[model samples]
Target: MSTITPHKLGLHKILKHIPLNAIFDAPAKARLAKAVNIADLRLCAKARAHKMVFDYLDAGADDEISLRRGKDAYSQLEMHYHVLSGLKPPIDMRTKVFGCDVDIPFFGCPTAGNRMFHWEGETAAAKAAEHHGSLYGLSSLATTGIAEIGEIHKGPKVFQLYVWKDRELVKEVLAKAKEGGFNALALTVDFTWYGNRERDIRNDFSIPPKYSVAQVIEAIRKPAWTYDFLSHDPYTYACINTDVPADSLAAFVNSQIAPEFDWQDAEWLLGEWNGPAAVKGVVRPDDAVKAVETGFSTMWVSNHGARQLETSPATIDVLPSIREAVGPDVEIIMDGGVQRGTDIAKALALGADSVGVGKPYLYGLAAGGTEGVIKALDILKVELDRAMGLLGVGSVDDLKKRGPGLIKRRPASVRDYPDRYAYERGYGGGVI
Candidate 1:
């Protein structure tokens, strides 16, 4: 090696330099400024939101095993490309979900109490969904009422129905959904009882959020979020209570959710809607098969984002078996652990008619309101288009036809890592 030269160092006379400029100049603004992906948005969202709020949004039920497994399963999957397979430019991401033609292969899954995340909340997400040419599921517990979202977003919309203790309340909400021109109704069937979301239990998070001393302290740290909270109409469950008091979410669930809810209730709701309807939380293959037999037009294969059961199977891992169970006729839409465009493609390849994203859009909403949501949608769209091109497919149909061959599943291997990182072989590895 040559000796290091330290003396007589001077700037080169003709050195070339990259001409740098502001990404957003004066008189212009950047929304989602540093976020490049949904994961980045998650970080931004965490930074913008209080710790309690972030935990409520990020944490899953019990040990969060399902949540980790869901994400890990996606990581283990590898997609193969058909090199130079005569695929052309302008890859199509458009398809029909629940009889509505969409520009993308994904939709925003319904999440309750949007204003709790941000003041713009459901309306912003609805608008972003429309802007990207997709559907937005408005929650029964949405901060904005059905009529308002319906009036604003002209794109396809779905209303998530939770059977309540009050029959009249359920009927009233369904009628409003129909009047509001909702394209379909997704009947949520998983929450016979609330999951043990320990984050909420520990944080003492409540709907029509009760700000505890800890929360108030957190609010002071996140002053921007606090300002928005104060400036806007005080947070309330716009759909259910204008200002009703409840002991806790678990108590409210016990009081409101119909414990006796069964297939008969599902049938009644289906008949009441008398339109395209989906069973929202079918996890087992038999249940998926039963859903079709029960006259449901679609089966939303989900586990409530792993918020219901910690031990439940990852949605993607169970998707293929469910597809085989339901056969080719019934539509299957999946949600949970979708954070990338490749994740969307993987779901489609595995036989999902369409995918639903909840936390990704929520992250976007927490990061930058409507623009952030739009950014999240746009990012996924771009990633999907690029992934399609790389995978040597042009249309959604082509993707479905070749998906099984192009995608293969395998368990994550210890040998994949460096030897130092690899602890032991076989059974010994488990202990490691």
Candidate 2:
């Protein structure tokens, strides 16, 4: 009956069929809003940040084989799921870190120079940590000082110690950490020299950036990021914002960081802090045992996110052995190539008391500042809860109990040993 009559063209009906969502969705709230996962945030950051800045945050040591393997290794392990066997309701992620209860099993791992990424910087990350009921690791090279971070975040905080050659500066930093009420001190012990981060070399990256004309042109393309960079205070290492010359990160690291650091120095630093301490950058089982012997409260299994040693073993692959060596009691917190909730669960199941995430959170930080970091943690928490439910585990402890038996690594028979371990061990044992 309707076809009998000739109707005028109706703009309203045609417009309704056109789906205005494509025409006017406001470009997804700056793309950061569209990021539903950690990898998405990293992509968003890469798009927003200058290539050089992103490279500084992203690239690893020479060849970057270890860096690539750190993430690839986790993908080799598969988790077994149990059905209808989970606890009644409300799975818990809460756990203790040195007698202090933290709401999540993973905390933000410290990376230096947050201000270089965004104006909000460490403060943004610390606030997100507070909101998420987790800990924040403040770097000694942080743009925000310990006191400032301590003043803002009421949650668990740990100060990362670089053990610079300047002992008085080190003592002053310790004093500041104590005064700042940091719950723990993490001592990074793997920086003997700069790892040949060829990307940084190619970019000619530095702390206070020396902008080339090309870089300026690149910055012009990222107007929003450049706005934040120009409006914010100049980036400087807030922990020791004294007369130290602001130069290349490598130059400062080579000149200031103590290459002669040993166990005695670690012991003295532990004695000085006189609080819960974490010995970070340890990968060997023997080194794990030694860390326990050296009076550290926790052994942080890391390879400086593969920034220090290109040949370092993937941290996750070494975690099981470290756990066996350290026994049941020593808290093993690990960091490197953690991008997903499943990654966190996998690490927990492997006997990590807690996991540390650096680049992922930084990606979120660089993507949306404080809000982005909070969103990133929120995504992880949601994913963790879902994964726990699906895996039929009620708590972090439950995951730990189910972990060893359920998680399996890809067979070495099917794949080559990671390059670092490719040389078959005991090849000349009989001859020796």
Candidate 3:
């Protein structure tokens, strides 16, 4: 059994009390409905967290134009539906991911310092995934160690690894994960340098965020997250310390370990883990091609939740070409900007074998705990089933066909539009 699962009487019990009437009445539930209604989980999160955290989750490099475009691109494309499609009274949301069969096409992406949001941290996320028959991914920076979550949960698990200056540290963490029966080792490649998050700057965010008197009062309003947080001592948070060498939290983040990385280092990591090593943070077609050539079992595409690298390309915009470049043999997994089941469907339609979701589940963790996390996943399952039935597709195969037609090269007429039309039709529509 994996160590992490939702605690019913602890934090999740309150979730059972959330009245359905409150789905629209309660502020949190209402926002959850908004997220589920639009099939975008990010909406649920943006509504609740401190503006600073929201910006941290939502921002991207330079102007964030690509980030906006990434979601908007999905909006511009239309979904095709077949009426009276054979709708299973209830749909099957489970599928095979990596080498394990999860109940859904989703996994909890490893998120660090979860204690900042709730006391359970990795345990809540991992347990929720286990309950749903999914995989729980643990961050190298997580508050709850892999052992904790792995001990409590029975399901597929993944460890997100960051290469450090100390090779022994990397081996040590890997050994722990292996001992815990972790199934996959995902190496995050894009965080070679963290992104310029302006909101985090305003919040003065850190691994262990400092609290002001005002912050304490603000926390009092959300008793659910606060109580659990207080349940763990040390007042502030940060439970994961994998015996890696680092001085302070700042040093741990900035100078303590490796922030320098490249493809060669990644290939070496693949050899080191000597297991199912997936290259996370891949967003370019060429990079995806080389990832396979480099001998990775999967191309885990992401934009670091748009958290790192202010200049990274849109993970979604680059997915199609990468899928084409690598062909069907390679596994194309995606993350970033996925809030709804429809988002999951869209990615699958565009060649993603599956997706990894962040933030929204954290919202669930903050609002209710394990039950909240499970609610978040269950929300996605319902949304996905409805989306598939509406699209008139019967199964995953039907959904895969929906992929090719979803995106296409701009037609010359539409591409040129008024400018090119002006050139070709100038004699007929305007002065030569």
Q: Which has the greatest lDDT?
A: 2
Maximum-TM-score candidate: 2
How do these models rank on lDDT, best leading? 2, 1, 3
Instruction: Encode model 1's per-residue lDDT on 3-35: one tens digit a residue.
Output: 221111311111113111122121111425756
Query: Count of backbone clashes for each model?
Result: 0, 0, 18
Per-residue lDDT of 194 in model 1: 83
lDDT of 2 by residue, 222-305 (tens): 765665655444566788764453344666877888888999999998888899999999999998888889899899999998
Please list the Cα RMSD from the true structure of every candidate, rounded to 1 decimal place. 13.2, 13.6, 9.8
What's the lDDT for all of these models? 0.78, 0.80, 0.66
Q: What is the clash tally of candidate 1?
A: 0
| Model 1 global lDDT (CA atoms, 0 to 1) | 0.78
RMSD value for candidate 1: 13.2
Q: Model 3 reaches what TM-score against the true structure?
A: 0.79
